[model samples]
Target: MRRAFVQAILALFLVEAHPAFAEGPLHVDITQGVASPLLLAIPDISSGAIPEVANGEDAGVALAKVVRADLGSTGFYRFVSVDGHYAAADEVAFAPFARAGAQALVVGRVRLVGNNVLAYDCALYDVFGAHLETSQRILVAAPQWRRAAHKCADMVFAFTTGDPGHFDTRLLVVGQDGERPGLHTRLLSMDYDGANQTVLSQGQELVAMPRYAPGSRKIVFLSFVMLVPQLVLADLDSGQITALKIPPGVPSAPRFSPDGRSIIFSLARDGVADILVIDLQTGGVRQLTNTAGSNTSPGYSPDGAFVVFESDRSGDPQLYVMASDGSGQKRISFGAGAHASPMWSPRGDLIAFTLVENRRLRIGVMKPDGSKERILSDGERDEDPSWAPSGRALMFQRTAAGKALPGVWMTDLSGKLESRINIDPSASEPAWSGRRP
Candidate 1:
């Protein structure tokens, strides 16, 4: 068997906070300048004690692919496709990476353990001769063997940048399957790669805007059971469902406050549309916005004391922020017409929203103080921007030529679209969970 021991007590957990591996601020102007992304070169294990998942598949291929995929999705790191000179691992020099315009390289060795157990040892090097970083040995149980390779990839990501790691998290989305027109709506949750998709709900009715609770073990969404939209909460472990205490008519966009004690949503009360907040324990509803115009698409701040919502009080749909008690209301958006669907970043520093620019819609993020606005994407219609749990990546719905086509597109803080992560067309309103932050 492999060595069974604990050193520094940090090896027992998958992640440990260290300033030596933090993601610092990027000083470049993200709104205007479109610059080149840093090139990344990821090589496979050189031999030794390989991870357990490397038994059947090529160790180098499996580990290298994982690292490539994780880094590629960030929209920041570009993987360099170097074909030749991989055979001569020992004689590999810095010229190839330099010629390919690569800035960083990750190399590792996989040590094979007895029977079912394995260990992984990896090292990250800065091609510009800036720094050389290493990782502790990765010991894995047989069932969780694949996670060992993912751990090494995560360490490489944290070392190269000064931000918290997000490669090990999961994504829950609403996948629409079946033929056109008469389609079937079922809830699909999967890993970040769209694999291991598990159906959460299946039926004839429609489900929209599935959001993960603060802790991520539970989910809250809007469901139309009998032509009435009700706020429903489901537990992932027990598959049990509970109906929230909401009034009659349609109540959509259910978002949990920062403290997770109350939920703010939009209700079509009587005839006019308004935003309301419900106390989780007492089921008491407090109307937040009483504007005569339609009010919808509500979000909460990270501190649980303030909220940012959308309304047409300014003669056009725009974003607004207010206290938890519905006092001291202030406007945060000054963009062109139809600036709705504002989702507050969990980091409490930025807000991601949608706007109409040049008769087309695009996704953008700005400071909560209404400054430094930058559009990240452009299309015929791109609306409903959702933030990743880490607040580093933003996912939204995209439509071209107006056919009700919706696909998920992710981008980083620097406005780079890494991978398209496409799903079946007609998928819309994606909200990533807030757990892994």
Candidate 2:
């Protein structure tokens, strides 16, 4: 995945902290129930030495806009416009922002540091407290300037929320080009905010379920080559695609282990389907499920010690958990209707799944022990729940009632902070990537 996109060259120019308060008073307690978004102010960053431009825009303005957009998109911060005031890096007056109902403020400046290199000097301030909380200067190549803004937003989010930010991550999704029967699907890569979209496949073959390895740009997805569905591995860095050697049977639902050294998927031959795992290093295959019915969509626990999957051995498709080596298999879902596409959250606290009841499909999450299950989406059809790197949010495909195409939507753990991601054309099967290097 190192070459998933034009690799952004990121370097730290400077990092300085204000000793006034090690931990700022302005914090969003995410552990508690859903609270209103924290009011934040992000005025235009002051411009410094003009840099060689690629997008032909003011570097300072673009940087601040990106930062504001990143933080606001998380549904954690509500950006308040401070139109008349530009929060320059050197000077910041918090009184006006406080009167504007802003709890926190971000001030920054952008300048050219080297040949084709831009530096984003950002500082996070506590508006009411009248003190600087944290500040950083990040440098990136001109073409990848947006990364600097993402990093700055990440820093602010981390310091304020006490959780790592997912702003610096990527998303892999399947893009559909036409109607069914004659439809074409391609693998696409984009920023987490749905920018920098790049087609990874030729659209010649159908692609689905593109999953990123735990910590790499390498991905394993289900693709059809000449109408034969098989699991293929693609390395973004080298543009090499290798078909996994499977023993007969058609494969589906390919997912990487938490360690990224193996892939767990399901194979169906004849009338039975079971789950299997393949060791990427040795090309060794291991069967994890040998049930009489269909068992698919196997995903690994964050620790790689266990897996959660969907099985219909009990007459209705339900979620099941088992040891990594296929021991202690037990059903976890006994809810009304069917459950499919079980995904273990990165934090290992919950498992997200697709609930099909009375011809309605919705997204829901539950604890690993099959408790505290709750629906998170009310869309007509919501499936494919992919966790953010921080495990605080999920991205899924939502096709409203009477709507023909599905759009990507995101929701926080509480389901109260749901928003649709704006993507032109239709897309599905969103897979969030780990933070970019």
Summarize candidate 2's per-residue lDDT along 29-85 as a digit string, tens digits: 766654777899988865742555426666777888889878876778888876574
Clashing pairs in 2: 1-217
TM-scores for all predictions: 0.80, 0.92
Per-candidate clashes, comma-separated:
11, 1
Give residue 95's error in model 1 in angstroms.
Answer: 9.5
TM-score of 1: 0.80
- For candidate 1, lDDT tens digit of each residue in 1-437? 00111111112223323335624221112233335555778765444224445466766567667767776776656677565534314645666776776677776555455565555555565666645544545665533444555566667665655444566555666666654422677666655555434567765787777777786557788887787777988777666778898777678888887777778888886766778998887889898877777778888888777888888876888888888788887988886666778888877778999987667888989888778888888677787888875577787877666565566667777765635665654466676765332
Candidate 2: Cα lDDT at 153: 90
Q: lDDT: which candidate is best?
A: 2
lDDT of model number 1: 0.67
Among all windows of ten consecutive residues in candidate 1, which has the lowest summed lDDT? 1-10
